[model samples]
Target chain A: EAGVAQSPRYKIIEKRQSVAFWCNPISGHATLYWYQQILGQGPKLLIQFQNNGVVDDSQLPKDRFSAERLKGVDSTLKIQPAKLEDSAVYLCASSSRTFGYHQETQYFGPGTRLLVL
Target chain B: SQKIEQNSEALNIQEGKTATLTCNYTNYSPAYLQWYRQDPGRGPVFLLLIRENEKEKRKERLKVTFDTTLKQSLFHITASQPADSATYLCALPTGNNRKLIWGLGTSLAVNP
Candidate 1:
């Protein structure tokens, strides 16, 4: 079984520019998540999806960040008019269980390292 | 406000020794806590999970202890090796138990 896959291992953009990252989760996984991990800090959840439906996105910056899991297998996270504070690693993870199921182990992909100049 | 904290400084240990790391939290009663290992520039990999009801759990050379009363968890790697050098993270469930609140992580270096 393959683990979660992400594209563009690293990215650099200027402030106010737009950037997007992609994620392909493990096969048969029903839940996907996007997290932002700043240097020297733990990952902060940005959004979570269960079978194409959003389960939680309360921490997402609605004004600048957005994410979608269109077909339930792959997802994308976008940030527009990016700020210097947005320079962090964006991680994509997936789990085999449905949302609300506790004790599920999440498999993570090699995150995309984004730098905003 | 709820908060999770780990040792901010890196820990250095010799091979064959035991490495112990701590995770402390405040204002939250998580049902369970998780531990993960992350290499530089890579996402974290799941390592262990200990519940509030369980005092201790072990996997191979790794051991985890959870104390709900103290709101703390301890992760230990026994017979450590140089390959164990990495950042170890601890996470607790949020109020809803649907998401996790994470700690900054403690970097560990096992010297040969």
Candidate 2:
């Protein structure tokens, strides 16, 4: 089986510009997530989606960040008017809750490395 | 908010020795704790998960222990080899949320 897939493994853009990253989750996975990781920090959850609807986006910057998982299989994260602080790797992950297993293991994609100058 | 901490320094050990990494957390009691391995320029891969009620879980040469009262987890790799070098991370889901918060990760280097 294929793992979670991401597009434009690396991206470079200037501040105030807009950028977008895509994620294709593993087949049959019901949960998709987006996270941000700085140079020396762990990945921070930005948003999560269960099927086509968002599960949580409390950490997403409403003003500049937006994400959507239409039809529940693919997801896209967009940042408009990017700031220098936005320079970080954006990671996508997916997970599924199977019977008898209360916890699920998430599978991550290669991630998109964003450099905002 | 739940916070996680892992030693930032790289652990250096002989190839045949056992490598142990620590992960500590505060302000949370997670149902399960997970361990992941990541290399430079790559995403993390799942290694193991231990639940709160469980004391330990093992697979192959990897073993994970969770102590809820201490709010910590320890991951051990036995008969370590050079190929075992990588950053190890621990993650736990926040209260009632499916999203997991992560630790900065501990780098492990098994020397030959």
Q: What tens-digit string does per-residue lDDT give for candidate 1 at B1-112?
A: 9899999999999999999999999997888899999999999999998878899999999999999998989999999999999999998878553687789999999999
Docking quality band of candidate 1, CAPRI definitions: medium
True contacts kept of 2: 0.77
Provide chain B's TM-score, model 1: 0.97
The global C-alpha lDDT for each of the candidates, from Candidate 1 onward, is 0.93, 0.92
Flag clash pairs in model 2: none
Residue-wise C-alpha lDDT for candidate 2, range B1-112, written one tens digit per residue: 6689998898999999999999999997888999999888888899999999999999999999999999999999999999999999999987566568899999999999
Candidate 2 structure, TM-score to reference: 0.96
Residue B67, candidate 2: alpha-carbon lDDT: 93
Taking the tens digit of each residue's C-alpha lDDT, what string does model 2 give over A2-87? 99999999999999999999999999999999999897788899999989888889999999999999999999999999999999
Fnat of the models, one by one? 0.77, 0.77
Which portions of model 1 miss their true places by more than 4 Å? A98-101
